[model samples]
Target: MPLCRLAGAGALTLLLLSSTVYAQSSTATGVSRAANPALSANVLYLVGKATRHDALDEPDERHAADADEHGAESPGARVQEFELRMTSFVDPHVKADLTLATHGVSETELEEAFVTTVGLPSNLALKAGKFLGSFGKHNPLHTHRYPFIERPMAHETLFGEEGLNEVGAEVSWLAPTDWYTEIVAGVYNGDNPALFSGEAEEDVAFLGRVRSLVDLNDATTFEVGASGLTGRHEELSARSNVVGADATLKWLPLEAQRHKALTLQIEYLRGDVGGATRHGGQVVARVRVTRRWWVQGSGDWLAGDDPTVRRVRGLIAYVPTEFQALRLQYGATFSGDEDTDHRVALQYNFTIGSHPAHAY
Candidate 1:
C-alpha cells in the first residue's frame, strides 16, 4: 500500500485503541481515565515573504513539493505543520509514543512511533522503533519547539530538513555521578539520501554520544555534550564520519524564574566525506524579557568544499499563555557569489489537549 494510506491507517488504529482503553478504564473499579493515552495536537501557521523564492525553499524540496501537490499555498502564507501526538505507558515496564504530522495540507505521515523501557537495572534504558536520533542539541528539537523561526543553516545543510530521524534502536546509561551524566549509543538504517544511503544489512549507521551537566550556582547551570557518527555516504560512494560538540549555559533567578532568564548555546560540527572535510556551527542567545515576552538572536556559518554560507537572525515573541504564542522574526543569509537574501516571518503557534513538557 502507499505510504500515506499506511500512515493514515496506523493513526486510525491508535485512535481506536485509545478510545477502547478509555472506555475500559472508566468502567473498571478504582481505575482512573489516565490509563488512556494522552493526546495532543499542535498547529503552526506562517505568513512570511522572502527576497528570493528559490533561496527560501525548504532543504527537502521533495517533501515541500508533496505539500504543494496537495494544494498548499505558495511560500508566503500557509499552515506550516499540524501534528497529533499520543503518549502513554503500555504497561508497568514499557512506554509508547506516536506522532503523526502533516505539512500544510499534505498527506499525514508517521513522524515517530517508538517504545521505551520504563525501568531497568543499573540506570540503563532501551528504546526502539522509528524515532529521531539523539544527535547534537539542535537536531533533536521539533518544529514548534524551535527557538527561532527556522532551523540554522548549518543543520539544514548537513542533515536535510528533518534532521537525523530514522528507524533505529538505542541504549542509554545514566552514570552514578554527582552531576547529571549520560552515555548513549545507537544503530540506524542508513537511508538518508543527503548523507547516508547504504541498503545492505551490514551497512548500518552508528552513533555515540556523551553528555554531562553541572550546576554552576544557585541560579545558573551548564551542560556540555559530544557526539560522533559513522555511516556509508551514497553521494561519495564511501564511508563518512561526523563529529559534534555543544555547550549550553542558562541562568534563572530563584525569586523571578518566570519573569527573567537567559540562555546561551553553541554547537560545532565537522564532517569527513570522501576525503573532504566540512565545518559548520551556530551560536544562539535568548532572553526572557517579561512574563510573556522573549527576545532571541542567532548566527550560523558553514564552510569547506563549497562556498561559505552565513546567516543572522533575530526575533521577538509574545506568549500570551502556555497554549499559544506569536512571534516575528527577520533573517538574512549571505553566500559567496550569490545575492544576499532577506526574509521576514510571522508565526502563530497553538496547542490543545495534554502536551508533554519539552526537554530542558
Candidate 2:
C-alpha cells in the first residue's frame, strides 16, 4: 500500500477503536467510563516564508542538523505536527500515558510512553519507559507547546530536533524545605545519535536535575533549575557531558490574573563532547496584553567550536479559547559572517477530546 494511504488507514482505525471503547464503556451498566483512558489529539498547521530557500541545505555544520526537523524552512504550508495522546491511571498507585506523533506525512513515531508511580514512600516517585528527559525547560516541551514557531538555534544544534528523549527509568524526590524543591535522576540506554550511541552493552546515559520554586510575593513567583547528563559518544568512542541552568520569573496581578501577566525565562547549556566544547543560551519574554491576546520576544546566542550564531524573534498570538490559537511570528538569523536570513510564519493550533493541562 502507498505510504499516505497506510498512514490514513492507521489513523482511522485508531479513531474507530477509541470511539467503540468509549461507547461501550458509557452504555454498560457495570462498566465505569472512568476506567477507560482519556484520549486527545492536537494538531498544528503552519504557513511560512523565508528569504533563504537553501538555508537548511547550507554546508555549515550549524545548519545541517536542522534540515529535516522544521517545515518552516521549506517556504510552504504544511501540517507541522499531529499528535494523539492517551492517559489513564492503571491502578490506585500508578498512572500511564502514551503519545503518538507524526510530522508532515512522515511515519508515526512513539513520542512518549511512560508509567509513573503515584504514592510512594518518603515523597518519592518512580517512572519507567520511553520519555523526554528533564534536561532543561525547553527540551521536554512538545512542539505544539512551544512559545515560538520553532525551537531555539541552541537547542536544535545541541539536542537535535526531538531533544533528549530516551528509554529510561527515573526517580524523583520532593525535598523537605521551606520552598518547593525537587530532585530527579535517571538512567537510559545511550541511543540518541546526537549525543550518544549504545554500541557496547555497557554504554548508558545518566541524568540528574534539581529544581526549586519560591513565591516572591502575592502575584509573583521565581523558579530555578540545574540539569546534567553524561553518556558515551558514538564516533569518538568516549564520554560526553552536558550541563544546563535555567531561571524563570512570572508576574500576575491578583486582580487580573488572566488578562495581564509577564513572564521572563533564561536558560544556558554547555556540552563537552570528545574534548570539544560548545555553549549557548536563550532568553524569552512573554506578556499577556488582554484576555485573548499575547506578545512574546526572544533572543538566542551560541558560540564555541561551531561558528557563532544569533537569532531574534517576535510573536503575536490570539487565543480565543483554551482549545484553539492563532499566531504570527517573524525571526532574523545571523550566523558568523553569512548574510542575515529572515523568516515569517503563521500558525494555527487546535485540540480535541479530554486533554490534561500542561505543567507549570
List TM-score per model, in order: 0.86, 0.87
> Which candidate leads in TM-score?
2
lDDT of 2: 0.85
Residue-by-residue lDDT tens digits, candidate 1, 1-360 = 699999999999999988887677545546776578999999999999778655444533655564357534365778888999999999999999999998777567888999999878999999998888888898877789988977776676667666788788999999999999999999999766556753555568999999999999989999999999889887677987889999999999999978999999999998776677778899999999999999999998888877888889999999988799999999898878889988889999999999578566
Tens digits of per-residue lDDT, candidate 2, 214-301, equal 9999999999999999998977877889999999999999999779989999999998777878888899999999999999999988
Error of 1 at 343 (Å): 0.2
C-alpha lDDT score of every prediction, in listed order: 0.84, 0.85
RMSD in Å for all candidates: 10.1, 9.2
> Residue-pair clashes per candidate, as listed?
0, 0
